[model samples]
Target chain A: MASNAGVAQSRALPGPVRFITSSIGAKVVMAVSGFVLVGFVLVHMIGNLQIFLGPEAINRYGNFLQGLGELLWVFRLGLLAALIAHVASAARLVILNQSARPINYSHNDYVQVKFAARTMPISGIVVLAFIIFHLAHFTGGKVQPELFHFQDELGQHDIYAMVTLGFQNWFISGFYIVANALLALHLSHGVSSMFQTLGVTAPAWRPLTHALGPVIGTIIFIGNVGIPLACSLGLVAIPAGAM
Target chain B: MHLTLHVWRQKSANDKGRLVQYEVDNISSDMSFLEMLDVFNESLIAKGEEPVAFDHDCREGICGACSLVINGIPHGPDEGTTVCQLHMRRFKDGDTIYIEPWRAKAFPVIRDLIVDRTAFDRIQQAGGFITINTGGAPDANALPIAKTEADLAMDAAACIGCGACVAACPNASAMLFVGAKVSQFLHLPQGHPERARRVKAMVEQMDAEGFGNCTNHYECMAACPKEIDVRVIAELNLEFMKAKISGRE
Candidate 1:
């Protein structure tokens, strides 16, 4: 077990992954990749918000993205690689911790750790699934027909219109809102924490994290949620009977 | 005041352990928590029952030896106070207090309320000290240190090496403990000579000792007897990274 102050006793067990996951070296890699992913998420959310410009604006945005074609695919693939690495490392660490204590502990009754730390995995998985569904329905064009009913003034199906319409549904909007809230919480801790994990959080840099973490999180949340808000408000035209 | 006690009673390290309930009557609210424990132990000795063997040396709270998981807290519920200094007034009369040893795989139970904390010593041995011979004693202020730097170092040094941070951590991570030690040395000139080596060796030792990786829970700081901040852990991480990049062995 890693020696901690006060805890003279430790039950940490050894494994190859355990060593890697616990080391300062590997944690740096995780932190760097996680930060990269946060950047990517911010950029992606910004791109998604172009739907607020209406069908022509939104489709043109998609076409411009499709304009890059292979380059965009490259970016997607890179993001996928980073996401996989982050998730894999986190899973490995979680599993190692679970195994370290073979027996179920009858711990003291009060909860000690922060709710964010305790719920990271569960929240991560939820956000992961949300992202997959979001990509499939909005970006991948795999489920385009479902959203095609929301044609714009140009007689083109506006993805932005579909987004606003999507949020009009209370159930869908509620899920989106909840997921975005969780996303903000995740980003708030994740961004600041990644810097520390990378060992870059000096006294000078510490204040930056405290300020930037919440700011970046708020911006992404606003950008992502803005689409549904516009749709629900009828600022964008959704075709009759569009879900 | 009366308090219900749920104490861990084990015959030995190898015995099956369980919590046995008891009550201590007319306990004074001003009494430090450990003093109350002393009273209970006296009762146990009178009954010919084995007294709960806990590790404590300096009741004044600087020894870093008084470790207990009280009411699911590392050192009772108060922030920035050791178990030895935790007063009964924080707890209400008739409060049910559950106490146990710090639970970690590496920290095996030696007896009731005591565990083998030698793992910390082993990690320290790995490289907590600066290999320097400044002679018996240097001038009181021979080397200059910035007031801010000195204060920060002292703040980190305030970490009594009490294991409350580890016990408070869900994953039982030792990052705070190692980080505080690393930061204290890194903050001063004397520590500069062995900075890189110290970080690398201590972190390697910490990992080898089988502690879980920190996930930024910050519970360690919350439960810290000295309220040692998590920033020290951040400093330690910074030191560790620089050491690795600079190829310090």
Candidate 2:
């Protein structure tokens, strides 16, 4: 009996493994990866905001990142891993959640469910598509190489020219604006939800916890959208020397 | 008062149910929701038709047997009140109420508003207990539990296993129910010995039962008859993390 029990135990998932495999486990993975991605977005926005400081500052920033070289690739790989984990876990969770309720309630109502929470998957997909387009436009230089390929006066990759040229196009600027709006919605739900999933929510901190999502989401939205808006409106122009 | 109710009706577990409309006339405003159902059932019996089946015991709302989703809100529009305690006065005359069973893949419809909530019992059986010595009752003060902890335990203990939290959840998650059971024990000294093991066993059982995960929508808390806090879910997650980290399955 003892041997049989031991064999069965070995066949079954161990405690930690089982914990990560469960629904809550998937949620925890999404939450943690979301935190990493949120941090990246904030830093990326701060870096991009250097456009206000003129061509040299922005080009210097780009050069600094390029200077990291192989280490930069390592950072890129880490961000990629976080994105993949977040997406995969969320996809699995969505499937499991849909399967849990085979029948639909004809008159389902939303009492406390927010618009942001209801549209998380939709916003997440939009943000994902935007991320791919963004990479193609800037990182890969494959979208419009003619405009994307330029060098600043200091012989650095002309990020300022690329950003201005890209956003000056009405369609591209509009897409960026819309995508950032959706990202705001996604973050509004996702930020506070991460705290809840990680078990950091306490009754004493309810107000602060609830406000975290919307606050961060608004800041990101304003910061990101401000760039494209300023670019299209000619408020921030590519410096003459840099072009 | 006259009211129209679109109550869900199914003959058995395998039967595909649909909404069957019934009209109840001359219902007093003071009549409880279940009492109104009793009147309708009487009329059905007189007409030689099958009475609508539903679960209800201790009609005072403590039994947790009453499970009904009225107009998309579990237990009716009022917060913190069970279906058994809901009165007809809350609705206007000539109102049409949409009534349905607690819809979940795990909790199948047995008949009309009755769902097989035995899944909850199975989850409870997995770990919702403490090993006790078979002897005379110990003194209440012997455990030396802090008043705050005792209060929190009682708050969680108020869960009646009615499955309202699951019904109210968009994902059909039983997290609140499982969290309540785990929290109730976690706060008490008697639950210390089996703390890690209990959380692991119960969480494993919950996953095996195929309930959806919580996404912090807070609908379950709003729809809960006992008003169980969603924070308990955080507690459950914390306990599960500690158990896994401690390597104590």
Q: Pick the candidate with the highest TM-score.
A: 2
**For candidate 1, lDDT tens digit of each residue in A30-117?**
6877888888888878877766554566777765676797898899898899888888887877776665444334665334465666
Reference interface contacts recovered per candidate: 0.40, 0.64
Scored by lDDT, model 2 comes in at: 0.89
**lDDT values, one for every candidate:** 0.76, 0.89
Per lDDT, the best of the predicted structures is 2
In candidate 1, position A26 carries an lDDT of 61
Model 1's TM-score against the true structure: 0.87
Worst 10 residues of 2 chain A by lDDT: A1-10
Model 1 Cα lDDT, one tens digit per residue, B72-138: 7888877788899899999899998889888876577899889887878887887898887666888
The residue-by-residue lDDT of candidate 2 on B13-89, one tens digit each, is 99998998988898999999999999989999999999999899999879899999999989999999999999999
Clashing pairs in 2: none
